[model samples]
Target: YTFGVGLITYLCSKEIYVMEHEYYSGLSIGIMAIVAVKKLGPVIAKWADGEIDKIEGEWKQGREAELKVLADAIEAEKKEQWRA
Candidate 1:
């Protein structure tokens, strides 16, 4: 998604340069690039962090549930052996 947006912006800037050289000046492009990066950087960071948190929560829950099941099975086996 980022790549696609960057490609389209590049193509658009090239077209703008061909149409009006002054509008595509270095300062203008640099400022625009900085603003876009600043705006997107925090959003991407928050999204990535959220996904990581969700995955970690799921892993912890899964491990606890698995351990509980194993412990129950062991207890049942021990009870059965004692009764025999």
Candidate 2:
């Protein structure tokens, strides 16, 4: 959204001012980038945290399955020892 507006602004500025004096252009871009980060940073952080949670859940499920398998094996070993 901001990028689109910035692009249009840059194109228009280029056409009107020939972009020879690039300070304004650079400033506008810098400002836009700062605004973009300020606006999107928390959203991005939340998304990253959601992704981390998903991976952690998957890891926990895998560990639980492994634990179940190990427990079953241990139970069988104990039963065999009791029979012996």
Candidate 3:
């Protein structure tokens, strides 16, 4: 978008820049860049949090599954000894 604006500004330079001395164009571009950053801040933060949750959830699930398997094996071994 900034590149698009720059290209447009260059193309319209003879008319816009000639009248305003490029200050207006520069200010518009600066304002647009700041607005874009403000808008994307929350979305970026949410994306990071979602990624962290996915990674941590997988790790927790893997640990629980491992513990369950270990407990089941121990129970089975005890049953076999009791039968003996």
Candidate 4:
């Protein structure tokens, strides 16, 4: 959606300059760029937050599984030592 707006702005600006005498001033163009980035900032932040959540969840599950494996190995070792 943001890309579409930026593309349209760029195309329109080029067409206007070539076909007509109209031109976008540097300040106006800079403002448009800033607006686009600001508008998309929230969406990008949400995506990043979701990604971090998924990674943290996976890390937690992996740690639990590893701890269980270690516990089982230790129990087996203790039983073997007792039998010996």
Which candidate gets the maximum lDDT versus the true structure?
A: 2
Worst 10 residues of 3 by lDDT: 12-21
lDDT of 4 by residue, 5-73 (tens): 998889778775253323457667889989988999899999999999999999999999999999999
Question: What are the models' TM-scores?
Answer: 0.56, 0.66, 0.52, 0.62
Question: Runs in model 2 with CA error above 4 Å?
Answer: 1-22
Assess the local accuracy of residue 49 in candidate 4 as a C-alpha lDDT between 0 and 100. Answer: 100
Each model's total of backbone clashes: 0, 0, 0, 0
Worst ten in a row by lDDT for model 1 = 15-24
Better of 2 and 4 by lDDT: 2
Better of 3 and 4 by TM-score: 4
What is the alpha-carbon lDDT of model 1 when measured against the actual structure?
A: 0.90
The lDDT per prediction is 0.90, 0.93, 0.91, 0.88
The TM-score that candidate 3 achieves is 0.52
lDDT of 2 by residue, 1-84 (tens): 999999889888779635556878898999999998999999999999999999999999999999999999999999999999
